[model samples]
Target: NTDVTDQRSAEEQSRYLMGELNHRTKNLLAVVQAIARNTARSTMPEAFLDTFAARLGGLAASNDLLVAQDWSSVHLEDLVMGQLRTIGADEDVRVVVGGAPFLVCPQHAQVIGMALHELATNSLKHGALAHPEGRLRIVWTGASSANWKLEWDESLPSALVPPERKGFGHVVMVDMVERALDGVVKLEFRSSGVLWSLNVRGPGVGR
Candidate 1:
């Protein structure tokens, strides 16, 4: 009887560990999917490699934060700052971030982190951050404990024309980011600049 009980206990522990492993594996796959999908959006081979390398670096930074918390959740500020720093856009003169304090699930952190990376990249390439006299303002407000909204607006020195075609950045925001978080994304390309707004449902937010 003693031996049988020990064996059963060991089996139960093994199952528990397997469950944990599955969760981690799923998260890793999600990250890989994001990378693959975004990378596929590039048109030129050279651009693809460079963009992929930079995006993967951003994903890794977000993963580091989530791993530190045992994959529970990540702080809003940390998520935003990590993406900004990863893309080398953390400068105060060019970028502005303001939001209420809160936490987001690990999945949300990863998705939003990638979205931010894309936005920063686009800003640097074609939007406000591309010009010396441009500025970006990012703001967020919580509608309730379970709902929040974030906005990105870029101001340029002069009016600029919108792109003739939608790019990978648009796909990342409208398809991947929106579907993953069950969120709403709106992109407005004005002559003066670009504006992006995201409404998120923070269902798995952690304290």
Candidate 2:
């Protein structure tokens, strides 16, 4: 009788895990589909595969942190450092990250993670990371129990010509962030480089 009871409990746990796996699998696939669609739309046919792969890699990096933390939440510092580490800039003196850490929900984590990745990738490809005299600074502060803010500033040696159009990364930063955090996003490509900030208010900042 005891053996039978143990078997039943084991089966129940297995079923629960199976259900969780299914749910996460579906969620990941949905994100990938969205990424694919958007990447295809924004990239030239010849450049699509590489672009999609890099974006997917960014998503995977976020997922890795989530998985390590049992999918409940991710620390803001971890998210920022993980993304920067991908491009070998984590140890660069020119790149400075100073901020108050926050526990971000999975939904916000995904968007912010990708946004950070895109930002770092851009720097590596075209911004300060590409030049010796450039500097990049990232700072975040909690305004109160109900709000927080993040500021990203990149300084290049010379003025950057703003893109003529908004591309996939640009859209991801402004649109995805606003939707995820119930926040206001201000992004601009100033003469020096890029300046982007987000101020998130209400209970959503912590949640």
Candidate 3:
């Protein structure tokens, strides 16, 4: 009777564990499906879906990094490097990272990751990365007043002028900077290249 009771208890535990796993799996799938549906219905369907999927994947990757760091804040440089890896960036691509490594909260890291991804994708499709002769220069520096400045300069001399209508990428970049990060973005359409400057106060600065 003891042996039979032990077997029944073990089976019950296994069944409960399986049920929990199934429930969590179903919830995850539902989330993904919702993301896909909303993305597909966006203004720029293709770019929206692509970026949405990529951002979701980036969040997963960032989560892994967070786990590795025991859920503590991550260094800015480490977060940037980890995100670049998700998009297959390397030394040969003229990518440069600068500034002292500051610890970034998880929420800030995710937003920055998405913003960076948008910048990269824009360069790849219509900016610097579109031409072999073009170059992309990214620089970041800190101000004494606790503000951070980031610049994205793309050298595409032969590229066409900026489109009259702003697309999804443009909207995402603008929203991430102004709304999400509470930053200011300045866009310049110089003859030599396109310059984008973002000035953001560090987290908790305004609030």
Candidate 4:
């Protein structure tokens, strides 16, 4: 009788552990599903779900990269390039990146990654990357106040201003910059191109 009771207790413990794991897994899936739903609902129904999924996946990839580095900051240049590749943009896609290596906190890195992804997706859909003759220039510099400024300028020949209706991508970009990073975003519509400026502050340079 004693042996049977011990075996039952062990089995119960194993079952309890498995149940707890399953519950946690379900909760995680629920969170991901909520994200997908929110993304879809925020944009027009015609917006591509695949694109939304891809952006979320990009965030996951960035998270993994940061994890590999033990949650330390990442180089701005490398992080930008990695996010670009996540969305299937080739290095030869008229995309120019220039900046001295600078470190950004993990939280900053994630926000920057999302912002970059949003901008790249917009370019691919309607801004610069839509046309073969178009070009994108990304530049970054550090300010004396320990702030950082990154700019995205695109020269799309004959390109028109973005539509009056702001999409989910735009909303996400603005919110991430303002709320997440406490940064400012300036968007300009020019006859020759579109220019975006992002100003952010973090730990001092070389920290």
Writing each residue's lDDT as its tens digit, candidate 3 over 84-175 gives 67767645465666666567665556566656666776567677767777887777777335688778787875944775765544655676
lDDT of 2 by residue, 1-207 (tens): 999999999999999999998999999999999999999999899999988998888898899999999888778889988888878888999988987657888888999988998899988888889999999999998745666888889999998878888998998898989987879999989989998898887757554
Residue pairs of candidate 4 with colliding backbone atoms: none
By TM-score, the better pick of 2 and 3 is: 2
* Poorest 10 consecutive residues by lDDT, candidate 4: 198-207
**How much is the lDDT of residue 83 in candidate 1?**
81
Model 1 stretches with alpha carbons more than 4 Å out = 1-19, 143-147, 201-207
Alpha carbon RMSD to native, model 3: 6.5
- Where model 2 places Cα greater than 4 Å from the true spot, the runs are none
Candidate 4, residue 129: the lDDT equals 84
How many pairs of residues collide in each model? 0, 0, 0, 0
Candidate 2 all-Cα RMSD: 1.5
| Residue 80 miss distance in model 4 (angstroms) | 0.6
Model 4 lDDT per residue over 1-207, tens place: 999999999999999988966874685466467557768777666765776677787777667777677668777777788877876774755989998777777766776787788888778877788888898999998744567888999898895676687766676667756776777888776766778888877653223
Looking at model 2, report the run of 10 residues with the lowest lDDT sum: 198-207
> Tens-digit lDDT track for model 1 on 1-207?
999999999999999989998988897887677677757765677677787788788788888998898888788778888888876788658888888777878867877888888888888888888998998998888735677788989998988788888777678767877888788899888888999988877654335
Q: What lDDT does candidate 3 reach at residue 166? A: 59
